[model samples]
Target: MTTAVSLQNVSKSYGEFKAVDSLSLDITSGCVFGLLGPNGAGKTTTIRMIVNITVPDSGSVYIFGEPASAKLRSKIGYLPEERGLYKKMKVREQLLFLAGLKGVDSKDSANRIVTWAERLKIAEWLDKKTEELSKGMQQKIQFIAALLHEPRLLILDEPFSGLDPVNTSLLMEVIRELSKSGVTIILSTHVMEQVEKLCDEICLINKSRKVLAGRLRDVKSNYGIRKLLIAFDGGDSFLKDDSLSVERFPEHYELNISSVEQAQQILRKAINAGAIIRKFELLEPSLHEIFVNKVTGVDG
Candidate 1:
């Protein structure tokens, strides 16, 4: 399998503070890789090293099978947490300038910009100054600018920030399209729901160290608790079983089963106890659950 990016014992420090520890990770080509961690967890530092914004104090990173050199930089489109744009420049002008910096021709950049703008329904604002647009519109323009150079890998930090739900969904569609067309993406965000839905693989970092890394489904199953949530018309005593622990919600009760077979057995017991079942679901631990467990060091 081809790797889009690889980090081997990568670390960074400022004076006495180690920001990123000896972190080893791999992002496969043509996949949306989620890089997750809480704030001040060295996410930005790792991204900077990958983009060559800062030299790592130790270790190495390989981008597309080569050291992260100047040439490889062009193949990466980075949308940082801190957004930057020349406030006075027109939307198209700023994009064209950025594309030119990446060795993109004016004509092709213009074509790509127009296509993206039109698709995103922002063709009307191309001539407007960057500062004149609303935050959402500006975000759209900035996103287009990132894609204008057709970078092979896109690094987006908090990509959904400052957008309404509608625009967030719109950007999600665009990100999905980009990945489908063979662009590898490293999506770093605190939003676990987005990561759960979009990422094929993930790396969870905490305090500059990797706490979890693997395929998304496998990681969930690895850290998940076997449980089931059921709603039925019966007294609370119906849930009394030695094999399960029950927690009550307003509308239903959650049964923490020791095994899948136990869940099935619980259902049979509920039926036998004259319960009219309304909702029954096997509970899979969400990204939030797994994240809390790992970061809190609560395996038991």
Candidate 2:
């Protein structure tokens, strides 16, 4: 397995506060890797170090086997959480300039820009100033700019921030295609559902430390069968058990159970309580559930 990005005991500090502790992580090539954490958990700092926007105060950051440096950074495309664009500049001119900075030729950049804009359904807006577009439109433009040079490593922070469901699905499909084409992506987002659907591996950090890291399947499997989803009417009375964590919906309920024995017990109890069970099944722990548990220091 080739390594796309590697951090060795990396630490960063700002004034008296430590932004990142002695953290070490490896991202494999051609995979969509999730860098997830709650707000202010060193995710942005770590990404900055990887893209050479900020140097680590201690230890090292390596990209594609080379120490992160200006020369090596051209192979990286970074979309920061904060949106940045020359609001006054035309979208075409802005993208051409940014792509040029990454060593893309003017002719090639123009062609690629047209291709991307068409694919993203923003071709007609290219001649307009970025400030003239809506937030979602500007976001799509920025996303296009990031890939203009076709970098090997893509780092996206909150890539779906302003997108509606349709555009969000479009972007997700594009990201998966990019990964299939061998572009390694570092996705930093608070959206757990997106991480579950897109990422092959993930790392969770909190308070400047890693709380979890592994292949997505292995990480979820390690937690065992602890969740149950069922649809039933009149089962609300049986859900009063204090030991179970229940999330109620109009048509179904999700319950957290300890074991198979506990699940069977709950099923029987619900049935005997004059409830109709439309569906019942054990479920794998969701990424959101795992994230909340880890961050809150809750076991199982």
Candidate No. with top TM-score: 1
Candidate 2, residues 36-128, lDDT tens digits: the string is: 999999999999999998999999998999999999867999899998899999999999999999999999999999999999999999999
lDDT of 2 at 272: 91
Tens digits of lDDT, candidate 1, 31-61? 9999999889999999999998998888999
Worst 10 residues of 2 by lDDT: 233-242
TM-scores for all candidates: the values are 0.93, 0.91
Candidate 1 accuracy as lDDT:
0.89
Compared to the true structure, candidate 1 yields what TM-score? 0.93
Candidate 1 stretches greater than 4 Å from native: 238-245, 268-274
Model 1's number of clashes is 0
lDDT of 2: 0.93
| Clashes, model 2 | 0
Output the worst ten-in-a-row residue range by lDDT, candidate 1.
235-244
Which pairs clash (backbone N, Cα, C closer than 3 Å) in model 2? none
